[model samples]
Structures are given as structure tokens and as C-alpha cells.
Target: MPELTQAQRNSLAILLDSREERIRAQMDAANVARTVSAGPEASDMADLAEQGAEERMDDAVVDHYRAELGDIAAARIRLARQTYGVCLDCGEPIPYPRLQAYPAAKRCTPCQRRHEHMHAGPDGRR
Candidate 1:
């Protein structure tokens, strides 16, 4: 694959940096939610149920952010290795627009779709 232009590199760097910042901010929020205690003891089943739901949601959010951080880190490694915009599957160049939309994408759209299809669970979720 051809090397990314200086302009494309700069643009992708900015995009990755911004995404990392946003993910970190969201992680902080999720962490706070997990750490914060419900001020009073639950008086009824409803309150307990609500607290449980909130905790689950917070955990899910934090987990998602952690995964996103990993993806961003991998993308940064690719950037440093001068392999940032190449699809991992077909070794073709990933389009700039797709990279702009998802800075951590490892595969081109078609390859990604195939990968998801292959890896999807019985419920059709990847």
C-alpha cells in the first residue's frame, strides 16, 4: 500500500487524538457512577432494583470505554508503524472517509462486514 500523505496523516492523528479524549472523558464519568454510593439505604424493592439497573448500566459503559481505548491504542500503534490506513484483512487502503468516521477501524467496510458475519453469534450480534 502507498504511504499516507502528510495531510492524511495529520488529519487522522487529530481524529484519533480527539476520539481518545472523548473516550477518556466518558470513562471518567462511568467510573464516577460506579464509585458513587446511593446516599441512603434502599427502603423498598423498587429502589434496590433501580440501583441494580444503574450499576449494570455503569459497568457496561465502562467496559465499552475500555474496549474503545484498546482499539484507539492499537490504531496509534499502526499510525506509529506507518500502517494506519491499510485494511488488516485485504491489505488494501481503507478509505479516508471511513477512517474519519471510525478512527480505530481495522478493516475496510466489506472486509469488516464479512468478519462480523463470520464472527456473529446465534443471535446475529457480533
Candidate 2:
């Protein structure tokens, strides 16, 4: 396989930057959630409910960040294997614009659409 081009290298840099940002955000969210949970108990039912909701939201944000980090890690592995821009399903080169928009993409648009369609839930979401 050919080595990454300059544009691909730039995209990889973006992925690395994004990974750092996500890790920091995830850690911040986790720390805030921990601190809030360890603080004084809520004074009332409404306050307790509000605190619970906030904790759940924090957990969701952390989960999102973790998922994105996983994707970035996978992209890094592909880069190491010299297959970063190739569609995993079709073995075709993923477009540069798509990679620019989503550096961790593992499939070309058409293949991605098909994969999503095949895996989508009854409500049409993946």
C-alpha cells in the first residue's frame, strides 16, 4: 500500500487533536459528576431529581466522548496499517472530502449507507 499523502497526514493530525480534546472533556465530565455525587445530599425531591438528571447527562456526555475516542483509536490503527483512507467494506478509497469532514470514517459513502441500512433499527436509526 502507498504511504499517506499530505492531505491524509493533515486529517490524521485533526484526529489526534480531536482525540486529545475528547479525552480532556471526558475527564472533566467524569470529575464533575464524581464531585457532585460526593457533595451534600439534595434537600428536596425536586432537587434530588434534578441532580440525578444532571448526573445522567454527564454520563451520556462522557459516553459520547469515549465512543469518539474509540473511533479515533481505530483510525490510528488503520493509519499504522497503511489503510487509513480505504473503505473497510468495499476496499475502495474513501473520498478526501469525506475524510476531511469525518476523519474516522471506515467506509465510503455508499458502503456506509448500505451498512447503516442493514443495521438500522425499526425506527430507521443506527
Candidate 3:
């Protein structure tokens, strides 16, 4: 894999740092919400219902954010290893513009398209 240009590595590092901070904040908020939801005060019927709903929403949001964070962390590790923009599936250099747009992307468009095409059949059994 080609080493990231110094400028590219710098850019990716900044983005990864920002993403990590955002994910940490999100996880913190989720943890607080979870704690609140489980507290004895939440046992009141009205409080229980509201907390349940909020907990579900928080769960979904946290899951999404956590997955995105994992991707960003992986990309950051790749950057440190000088392989940040290489497509995992095709071994192609992912375009810089695409990386700028989605700094955590693991595959180039062609590889992603092929992957999606292969797995998008009915029943998703590919």
C-alpha cells in the first residue's frame, strides 16, 4: 500500500480525532441515559414509559454512532500504518476526494458497488 502523503495523513488524523471525540461524547450520553433508565426513579409508571421509549431511541442512536466510530477508529489505525486509503476488497487506492468526503471509508466505489451487488439479492443470503 502506498504511504499516505503527509498532507493526507494530517487531514485524516484530524478527521479521526474529531470523530473519536464525537463518538466519545455520544457514548457518554448513552451511558448516562442508560443509567437514568435503570434507576429506581424510573419505576414510576409515567417515568417508566418515557424512559423506556427514550432508552430504545438511545439504543438505536448509540448503536449507529458506535458502528461509525468503529469504522473511524479502524481507518485511523490504517492511517497510522500508512494504508488509510487502500480499498480492503480490491487493493486499489481509494480516491482522495472520496476519502475527504468519508474519511472512514474502507473500500473504493467500485469495490463497494460490487460488494453491495453481490449481497443485495432477495433474502440477503449472498
Q: What is the C-alpha lDDT of each candidate?
A: 0.88, 0.81, 0.83
Q: How high a TM-score does candidate 1 get?
A: 0.89
Clashing pairs in 3: none
Estimate TM-scores for all models: 0.89, 0.76, 0.71
Expressed as tens digits, the lDDT of each residue in 1-114 for candidate 2 is 354587767766676777668688768868876886768999999999998998888777778777877888888888877788899998988887787778888899999999
Backbone clashes counted, model 1: 0
Worst 10 residues of 3 by lDDT: 35-44
Residue pairs clashing in model 2 are none
State candidate 2's TM-score.
0.76
Indicate the worst ten consecutive residues by lDDT in candidate 2. Answer: 1-10
Top-TM-score candidate index: 1
Clashing pairs in 1: none
What's model 1's overall lDDT?
Answer: 0.88
Model 1, residue 100: C-alpha shift (Å): 0.4
Across 1-126, the per-residue lDDT of candidate 1 in tens digits comes to 455688988998899899999989888876676667756878999999999898888787778888988999999999999888899999999988888899899999999999999999999986
